[model samples]
Target chain A: MNSFKQKWLICRTVADVTYKEWSAYRTHSMVSIIVGPVYFMVQYFIWTAVYGDHPSLGGIELPQMIRYFGATALIGYLTMDFADWNLSMLVRTGKFLTFHLRPIHHRSFALFQKIGHRSLGFLFEFLPCLLIFIFIFGVDMRPASLPWTILSVLLAFLMNFYVNYTIGLTSFWLVQSGGLRSAFMLVSGIFSGALIPLDFFPHWLQMSQFFLPFQYLAYLPAMVFTGHYSLGGFELSIGQAVGIQAIAVLVTFGFNELVRRLAMKQFTAVGA
Target chain B: MKRYLDVYKQGMYSALQSAAAYRMNFIVSSLITLAGNILFPLVTLLIYRAGTSFPGWSLYEVLLIQSVFTMSNGLSSLIFGGVLWTTMSHVREGSFEVILLKPLNPLFFIVATTFSIDSAGLFLGGVSLFIFSAMHVGAIPVLYWLQFAGMFIAGTAVLAGLTLMMAAISFKWVGNSRISELADSVLHIGKYPLPIFPKAVQAAATMIIPVGMVGFLPASALLGRMHASDYAAILPCFLFLAAGIWIYRHMIRLYEGVGG
Candidate 1:
């Protein structure tokens, strides 16, 4: 129990360092902030068009649909971080060795700092987009199912951290995973409902939302405000979302450990 | 002209080598893009399932527009995907200096530096689907005689303008890459038949960014939803290309160098 607590503290310390390293520059922070909301606006425009003609596209209604996009937009900002880990490409190019000599868990520091940068970006960028959404739609900030909604959003973000981090680790094996990264980002958008509500997905695709971690990212919690996931469904969905995410994190860490050992061996041999 | 051709050749070769080095990733990226580009029709497909035209376009008419936009997108990225990194790391790292020191025009050299050959798969996928859809809608027209030429001019101008818009960011910021993602998203929107947007937003697509001119306007001209006089869009198209080059030249002076 004591050792577990120690590791947990170490993780937070690492996350904090990363946040500072990336967010230290005001200009860099501001540019990301500006881009996030503008990007969000284009997506918001897409949904508004789809809903303009019909009250419901797929089981989701107009008011609920608007709120779903609004909530997902905010929640996704917290999870859609990928840049720090992309440093692996830089590592291959010899850009990452400078950080390696530092006295820290290089991977954790790199991953967390990028998350920190993205978080600052989101706060500056998304806060106004959220307000603009509220102003336009008069969304009920208080959904009757607030607790589960919050829990699910947090779970969605956590699941994404693992999924995103593990994918970054692939750079160790692949010459360039940025291409794979692009594919992964686009796929997550579908799940996270960055482009369209998962509910609107054809029946087969929507079912995969259950099997994959995508539901946890965008759908289950989104349904919380949409009023689809009732009290009973909310508990089950949150449990599944968190559970799937936990299992995914474990599997990913397991993969990372095996890969790390092998990578170190290969890296050492090259040095020798 | 010979100098430009040689630059394009060297650029294309390195881009090919990058793809060759990472064949698996390259293949997967192309496949993934093919899926997203193809799947984009889903929204419009659902909308049109209600059974109506956008004043003059049939459902396939929009698909035709998507094919043109997507095909050009596929071709441009395949031919010049490397320019993307040049605007980011190259300039940020002052590798632009290596490029500038060469006798070649650094602008053309950087822009053609990396061809995303994988985008070829995407281009072919779009073209095949486009041809299939076009055939389903109508037999081949001698209009094909003019199709390739028309698409080339429109596509080249849009690519230059959009690439410059993204490159222009390096004037002030390092790692201004989310804007590149913005370019990708905007390209996705351009594949829409007429516009999937409200009138105001549609107007923005046309007037503000002029992306509509690239794919939709020209495709619309071929489809007869737009008259040939709409070809007047060609003026603005070239103007955007010129303006982008001018801005980039100015931005080049402001580069403080990649301190990071």
Candidate 2:
């Protein structure tokens, strides 16, 4: 085989190994699946209270809002990335040196491994849970623009992965990214609109979402899934969302590649 | 008790040295925590700005609950976090034997030895929020201030107790590491007004989980939103602490060490 095909095969094998590895942790994966519904349950009551005697709040009806949250839950599970954790750990423990000896790029290897891990998790946990939620909420679950939405979600995953990979590379210098990790965990839930709909945010902040990549992680996809964003809704524009997400993937990946090159120059393996 | 205090003082002194050696990491970690805690209140600020208020909850009232939860949870995690994680891991690895070899209570030693300075970022963020929201909450009687302090401490106690209990359960339940995450989800719910939840969830949050007292109930008492019965909410914290202690003791007896 040519070198390119050989590398691709190796990356594919990494994904397979990671999928089987993650599949062993049945109980851990099950927690979020269990927790997502309870979250929706709490959201159900909270929204009911917010919408009492009213048809909608902020232009979203109760059922639609609940469905948005349900979709957000599924999309969240699907797009979540922890490549930074793997990178940080490998750097901290000096295991990253081993990657230098391997022909495949570390970033490519980690990305493929995560793709495998998330695929198994999406299949075993998110798919069934989302279907059940669709039944419970009586949501249509049908996309207004299947092709565009699929493209948007694919870009969403790429953007999310590169963002994490960049953060993970920081460990090459920072040595301990645990604090950064916790901080990211806390901030992303809100910024990504997984905690609350970005539509409910103030106008300027919602506008800022057009500039920030975080919204592509959950908000944009969920909105696309809910068909809330038509070709153009209130001037924010679906075309703009797609444009920004595509640009974000390119810009973030460039940043990650630059960081990797710089960090690799100074990298010294200090431990076994 | 004095001996335990002395041990804790020594442990804290050592922790400070460790902090000094990794000063940059320590500072960055705290800043991260500070940033995280501050971002949630901003989310609340925007939600209310969108003209969608949680019925019966003014924006400031919700901020007050978020503030209280941050302070109580931060304080508990800062103080008991060492005990919480170490105890669970030690039990799992059968390293409880090493803890027993020390001439002190294993729980107290664990709690004392592990002082998380990083939580100070969260605690400070909470204080900032509490002070900022207090300006809008209006003047209150001195008694209400006292009531607020009492309830806050009690709420922290309940949080600490719940954490310890979950750690203890991890010993017996194997693969129950996620129980602590479950507890966290409960506290996450407490970020909003408890009254907004269904009666069943509210009841569970009050009696079974006692998470309501972790923040919402205490803030409500300060706001005078609680009923006569709600004043007794602090009563559950005592029971939770007692149960936690009892369970930890029972689990220690059952610790057979890590099996081959």
**Interface RMSD of the predictions, in order shown?**
4.2, 2.3
Write one digit per residue (lDDT tens) for candidate 2, span A1-272.
69889878887899899989888875677777667777777777777777777787667788778877887887777777889998999999999989877877888898899788888878877887787687875666666677767877888888889988888889988988877777777777787888777777767767777666778888888777767662113544566667767887888888888998998997997546
- Candidate 1: lDDT of B251? 81
Instruction: Please report, as a residue range, the 10-residue window in candidate 2 chain A with the lowest summed lDDT.
Output: A229-238
Scored by lDDT, model 2 comes in at 0.79
Best by lDDT: 2
TM-score of each: 0.81, 0.91
Residue pair clashes in candidate 1: A18-A113, B82-B114
DockQ score, prediction 1: 0.29
> Candidate 2 on B1-260: residue-level lDDT in tens?
78887898998898889999989888888888788777868757876776767888899988999999998888988888766677777776767789888888877878889998778888899989888887888887777788888888878888888888877877776645666766676677777888888788888878777888878988887887768777677788778878888888788788787541
CAPRI level of candidate 2: medium
Instruction: Residues B57-99, candidate 1: write the lDDT tens digits.
Output: 6777777777777777777777666565667877656666676
lDDT (Cα, tens digit) per residue for candidate 1, span A1-272: 99768766776766666666656564554443445455555555555555565666565665666677667766666666664256556546755556556666566665556556666656665565566556754665555467666666666666676566666556666646677677777777666565666655556766656556666667666666455652211234444544555565566556666765675454411221
**Winner by DockQ:** 2
